[model samples]
Target chain A: MALAEPPLGRTTAPTRPAPQKVWVERIPPIWWVLGLFLLTLPAYANDFILFQVFGWTFILGMIALSLMFLAGYGGMVSLIQMSVAAMAGYMVAIFGTSGIAAISMDLPWWLYIPIAILIAAIFGTIVGALAVRTEGIYTIMITLAIAAAFFYFTRQNYTIFNGYTGFNLVVPPQLFGIDWRQPVPFYYLTLGWAAISYGVVIYVSRAPFGLALQGIRDNPRRMAALGFNVTAHRVAAYTFASVIAALAGILLVWQNAQIAPGTAGIPAVIDILVIAVIGGIGRPIGPFVGALIYVLLRTFSPDVLLTFGLSGERFKLLIGLGFLALVFFSPDGVLGLWDRWRARQARRGDPLTGEKGE
Target chain B: MKAFVTRHPTWSLIIGFVVAVLLWLIFAPWTEGMEDVLGRKRVFLNAIFGGVTLGALYFLVASGFTLIFGLMRNVNLAHGSLYLLGGYIGFEVSERTGSWLLAFPVVFVVVALLGLVLQNQVFRRMEGEELRQTMVTIGLSVVLADIMLWIWGGQSYTIFAPDWLSGPMTLPIVSGYRSSGEAVMLKYPAVRMAILFAAIVVGVAMWLILNRSRLGMLIRAGVDDREMLAASGVRIQYVFLAVFGFGAGLAGMAGIVGGTFQSLSPGEDTRFLLASLVVVIVGGMGSIPGAAIGALVIGLAEQLGLVYAPTYSVVFTFLIMAAVLAFRPQGLLGRA
Candidate 1:
């Protein structure tokens, strides 16, 4: 089950039927209009909403994509992915030109980013090495313990992490004398990084390593017998995911203008898990869609509830109810449902394929 | 005798403890005024006491988690939510009735009923699907926590115990050295002692029920081979419901004791959940003695770490987990 080896060399050969021709005809014109409307939303949306809501969502969604890589493809449900990202973010703040004993002593941007990303990847590798031994719930628990350990350490140690306040040391540097924090600039920056990450993820999902990882997921014993080295693949997946998360971490610090323990604590970690599942674990685009929904909900729910004579904190109740409903009704999440509907329409339009009369 | 010693594990445990105590005594300072200033003697006693009390809470919660894991093979992530909900229910009940005794049992029963309903309605539908169950339970946990937040608000609450248990009491043990070479008196919290007693009783009862009863026999059999039991016409679903309810009830009991020991906050649910998960993982799942040992080790480590390395207390727990996982992947009491 080596994931039907990626059609790499045959990319231009048309070895298989094009997926678009099979499914695109079934989608209604209204759906196309809806897609167009969404694509044009940034132009109409307010700056406050764009910068605060959409910007934050993109950053968080990228982090969730890292977790989605592990849980959906690698069959490793970890709770420490955010902690790893936070670790990297904290490192940037420590190494950048703000802390008392900055690691870089004002090192150049090129040197700092690579060092932070490397450290995060190494940390993720160690966590994966420890985690790959256990399966199922044990992996979750171990990762959680690691995250909890990091959270407590960051909260208490003042010298390195700047204690509870964390490091408010770093902000996105001005490139070519342009302040990147502006809504449109920051949005583009985030969107560019997200697109790069999504591209890499899609490529990896079709790569040989990804195929082997999927084989391990489907049946580890069988894969192990076939000399696939399941544990190594899992650790590699984690390392790869950590690289993506570290990139997101850099963007996150830029978005927030600070790195605090709260950024990487248990709640934030769980929120990433929730975002990944909500977006739909089946595809990379799921994180973006889920993030959009979450960001909208979080931003508007409080104000909406306040208008309805309810306290803003009560908005969590609504979110919780919505999450449970989503899990119960659509375990594959919104994307899964959308895919099913599209397939159904495609089949209906083509009676031959629908009725097995082809 | 050598064979007997090797076969019976208790002999090795006794030997280990004796050697550990001897090492501690040889290393521990015994000078006048040193104990008074550093309070090392009292600290040791306090740490042990804290460990045991915390271990009791861990036992209550982890036992349920392990039981559910053993019987249903489903990691009930919502177990912590049930514990938190139990605390909130007890808090509300006590506030309304002005009676702690009535509040405790009422909360337990209510949570048990909730557990039963959840098993019948939600978990039963998710049989044989571990990942789906995880998501559903996690969703349930989030929903429950949010509902609790809405109902209880974000303020931390403390339960009031009886007057006698509220204050610290001086114990008869006089083991510390004063400046003038006299023994100094030490005080311990009476509530902690009470919790320890409750934990021991619960442990003993669980041991007896799990080892000596017919229901326990069926549970053990089912855990070993659910398909076999199903083929044999045994009602596995009923057993699952019972196990789930009982585990939830145990968590409720732990919550009441924990609320009294530590203040109840909205966030304590996840904290305790993590602690319980750590315990069950370190301890062998489905093994009562394993839970007890795991809880004690974690409890002591946490207390000692808090005293010595407050910043790295959680690291000690993780270290233990990593070590255990590296060497004994099935846990101390788990069958290989």
Candidate 2:
């Protein structure tokens, strides 16, 4: 049941007596190229590409990353990350301003943002508390049921949730004399958060807490016998993941300029799971890869479908089929495929020195 | 039951008190004060009946899900799709043939066949991989849901009960006294009552087969220890296939029941899926009687909450689930 990834091991240099310590030299050229391209994308890319596609990808990636944090590291495949995000979205709409004047308090951003994240984190913690009571597969079922409950509750209760219509015009605040919701600003906003989320998750994965969580994932009884509080670690992982999801939710609301119960609907919740699984939950970077693929498919599948004389609405069908194919062929998703390919290539000897490829 | 009562005397007393109060509420004619406090007796009675009938439907859907999960350890997320597919098929059959009874077996067989194919082809390939199987089912459900929507569209469909089951039947229980002191008995939809009766019959039959029959014994043994069952020379795959087909068929039939009680639409699949999940969670996964009890509690909570507190009815169901998970993670009747 403990689907552990390969151990993170550091490689020693063969030619040099001492390992190099330059951080920049340590970073691969591919990362520098990718980072440079992303950083300068707003300069040339259209508003749609910068705002809608990449922004959506980063937001979704962050949420899915939270799920990966749990499923990949904690071995708890929670479907509640989307709901937590939606809860933050709803809290922002309620505490700050929205089209629903009667409901919105119109608080300052400084006040509402913290409050929203806090509330969402609390909600996630409570759900995590309830969910962690069970083990393994039950986690999925319980979280899904809880997620459905949240959706239904939001749809039903009008006083706070504003009923089915939800809140509109829930745009981000204009900060530092700049409209953050603008394409360029929003792109950077989401990208910054996505990077922070990615970095935090990566860093924490190696931290003692994260290592302990992973240990608990592999063997809870053993962890417990070793004096680690298994339940507390699991719950803490949820809280950390929820903060990431809540941040993503706020950014998502700003990106969409509205919030609704459908934001956390069963389909949406399931979509987050699909995104995490399709990308590969084995690594922190996997969710972003999956989200990018998902966003591309979602954004462009309509035209592709239309070319085949099919309706645009068949995008879901396409996604479903693609998902099914991935599940059947590559259970670990695109990342798994990449890993296997890398493994195969590494087995091949280098042409010049006849040495095995790294 | 006697041993349980003796083992937990306090719990037995509390349960006894609650049951006695509920019986009194049902049988004893409400006074004017009582009516003023708790609304009309008819409304209360209707809510009770509504809850019970709804519970019947929940039990039908959830029992199959529990059985499949209990034995196969395959969390078939596509189960809800099977239910909806059955309902659509049932609707199509009943509509074309003009015979409500004719739809049941046809829908059951179709859905059951689909279940067999899935078990044989899809799940068998990923044996012992519970998470992967679940993911596949999730994928299957998404595909099935879209395909169903493509065919049925977004409009809701309700199946009509036959003439024999259509009108409301007056029960002996007095709802209220008329101005002239004449007793006004309770009148409930006959179709609902009949469906409730059918559900009860189905439940009893399943319990009987599981408890009394050899096949049931084999299934139970498999549930307890699959490796042992297979080692004993039984064709465990066939047993798995049969159980899966039966569970899927039962779910499909429940879809028809649900359509009759309410209506079927695209979202109903997810709705019923969540319902079954909550029922299984509360009742204990793989326990039929647990499903029944869980369904009953949830159904009652939903109906009663809807009547008394419209906004928070969902909270009641959720609270019940939360309480169960907190107190007994295995569920109310689940084994530790």
Candidate 3:
């Protein structure tokens, strides 16, 4: 898609309006089928599949989507998204009711949710301000350090964070006389939020703000020369990404029924990056696809390892090797591999790839 | 130094005052008033030594990190994994050979060879692609960590110092007054002091080599301008290989030092990686002296914070990093 092209050159020059198209015709049939499949999967899927697999995928996808928004579009590979998400999760447990009555304020859902997002957003903005001070690769290093600090602080501070053993039994509130924690309900809940976030990202990608961000990513100097506030745009991108991450975090806590330091630990932070990269950081849909792969591997790798006469704990090794291979062979991840294959198929009528002339 | 003083006279004065106070606290025997205001002189002395020694270890790890980044522009995130790997290998070597000193050369060779392979094979393929190289390192660290865990298991391992270095050595500093009017000398672990001395030697030798030697000139030139260096007919690949291998080797050796003082575990890789990252950030990227000063600051902050404010020690370290980042994004010693 040549995302690096500046979107400001061909701006609204007060010319005649472009032709309008029907919204229904814009979407391909494949998307409609995929959407329908996802929406109706709970009807036949088991409770385990509904609650654990798909629910976890959507939550992780949303978080990774936030990462893609920054890295793919804004050219900032931030490792702090997981930390921000964890902050939101922790805020929910702290502000809303939780297992620890002494620390948690026991506020209502409506009050605490917004407060959680707000606090997490501010935290992300501060991190963003600090990070945007540096350029390119420094962003990853700075964000990783800050993320580690957040983890360590959360683990050490017993007053507010409750220390090592964090909040537990933090289920979603029953808003409409329905248990949101149930497999079916949770599946639908995560699906709705994930769909909304995905839509938001897709919508924003073509918007002026997103275009400016892409332009800045390509050449900050040029963007600044064009009278854009480079730092402000970058920091604002973090704020926007943080909101998405925070929302995912809230859902993540509800899914787990707990929140702990491990949720946003170094490994977990890296895992988000892995998901985004492996899925393909070039597009918003990549994170969701990557999340699904990660969730499936995480859920099923243990059994697969045992079957191979290896310890189930070797799933990390498997994931590591796979990631290494992917980075080596296809830097843009699975999506890149798919893209090349499609391009090759388009070049020739290949029976092996099952492609005909377009 | 004169230029720095002239450039920021106020900063120089504040720094001079701080240094003066620190010297007084370290050298002068605390009176009752001083002892009351601060805790005991012995505790303060111990923290100072501890922090300095810890800083030495950090310098060992971070110097390599900075050097690698400086020469190759490769952010070797797996540098910590190299450290942990070296620790594990050092443990095995010492355990089998029954000689702690033998582990250094062996681990250095093995890990440095691994570094050579990574540079020549992996990173060289994706030259100039900074983000891809970083991703590969992250993946490498993960794979190496898991492999180490698979082989070493989840248990922690601590390499024992040789017999001569194991026991406590007394220093000339006055710890306190005895009831019979005798001065109580301060005693600390002999191994830590020896390690500290070794680190100083290494740091000095590296500085001398980099600043004074032809090889260092090549490296410095490469850092300043790789394309120019290459155009000058220098085999820049060899420079990259040597720096990467040497840095990896240094990190491996630091693993032995860390394993000697602190136990090596699965998560130590990440901890030390973060330490190196923070150190480089605070010290300034690709600057050896910066790494040293940053390490000292962070190490001191950590130990002192641990001693006085146990809960908020991490906070203090984080605050220093934040302040440095806020003020000088290039780092304390980094070139813009």
C-alpha lDDT of residue B139 in model 3: 98
Rank by TM-score, highest first.
Answer: 2, 3, 1
How well does model 2 score by local distance difference test? Answer: 0.94
Clash totals, every prediction: 0, 0, 0
Error of 2 at B1 (Å): 1.3
Give each model a TM-score. 0.90, 0.97, 0.96
The most accurate candidate by TM-score is: 2
- Model 3 C-alpha lDDT per residue in residues A206-289, reported as the tens digit of each score: 999999999999999999999999999999999999999999999999999999999999999999999999999999999998
Model 1: DockQ score: 0.63
Off by over 4 Å in 1: A1-43, A99-105, A307-309, A350-358, B1-39, B169-172, B178-182
Q: Give the clashing residue pairs of candidate 3, or none.
A: none
Candidate 3's DockQ? 0.90
Model 2 / residue A43 / CA error / Å:
2.3
Model 2 agreement with the true structure over A1-358: per-residue lDDT tens digits: 2347543343443545676669878889999999999999988999999998999999999999999999999999999999999999999999998999999999999999999999999999999999998877899999999999999999999988988999999998888999998899999999999999999999999999999999999999999999999999999999999999999999999889899999999999999999999999999999999999999999999999999999889899999999999999999999999999989878887767889986
TM-score of model 3 (first chain only): 0.93
